[model samples]
Target: MEKELETTVCEERIFESLYRKLSKSIHDFLYYKYGSNCNPNDTTQEAFLKLWKNCDTVSPAKAKSFLFTVANNMVLNHLKHEKVKLNYQKATTKTHTNVSPEFIMQEAEFLEKYNAVLANMKEEYRVAFLLSKAENKKHKEIAELLDVTVKVVEYRVHKAFTILKEQLEGFSIK
Candidate 1:
């Protein structure tokens, strides 16, 4: 007589099987979404850990979705906590000391000119330029935040640079 196979596997067995089957795929998915900044192995492990913890509620069939959801959330949380640091070097005229009147006047003048040019730029171009240069956001991130495409962001930023270059052609910090 042929014996019937088990319909329900034990939680441990199910977890192991899921891990073996989906870990690499989950890691690849997370890596693609988050780039190299996030450790895909760690995220994948954490996702499986969560699945194991909720094994009673999560079944083998549903584990893929659960793992992806957990991994995506982890990546987003990591991204949210990441800090973008910008190193700014101040431009100085050779003859002017830090506390010199000439330096202060030149800096103020440059700021005023820059502000004027930025104010006159189109809204979309200005937003993309600031997000890219000042905020240090990637084109993909900026596109998502602006609800536009990467091409649109690239186009706007290029247009902004063109306008600024034209406007500031004759203007210089002296």
Candidate 2:
């Protein structure tokens, strides 16, 4: 077992050397391909950790490609997990005000119409609308988060309103 332990330690050292050499370039490449929000630091760390854990399985020639593939998959998984979390948060965070039954009825009707209009919107438009209405995010903030122009956020908000107004027709909260 002592010889096996030594071999493992040697393998770990070699993996660390490779990781130190290739990490920056891989991170730069991923950042260029996927953009800045996806956190190159975390991705590179995860990729190398995977590589170190699986060192015996990875050949020297294919190691870099394996790292890139692992990083890319990590980024994709991160994006998907974020989407699921956002959707879950959006669903659960809605707060209903306690008011008169008549007022609550009106609010309910308006909510149904609002949801229907939102369903009709494109993902970008819907995202903007949710940020504006639910999160109360300003156009500048939404623009930064979505990586779009503030004017685009404004345009989407207006378009969302137009759609909602047309869909709701006589339904008024006030």
Error of 1 at 133 (Å): 53
* lDDT value, residue 147 of candidate 2: 96
Query: Where is model 2 more than 4 Å wrong at Cα?
Result: 1-13, 92-174
Query: By lDDT, who's the top model here?
Result: 2
TM-score, cand. 2 vs. native: 0.46
**Which pairs clash in model 2?**
none
Q: What is the lDDT of residue 148 in candidate 2?
A: 95
Provide the RMSD of all predictions against the true structure, rounded to 1 decimal. 18.1, 19.3
List the candidates' TM-scores in order: 0.43, 0.46
Clashing pairs in 1: none
Q: List, in order, the clash count of every candidate structure.
A: 0, 0
Q: 100-142 in candidate 2: lDDT tens per residue? A: 8898898798778778788878888889988998898899999
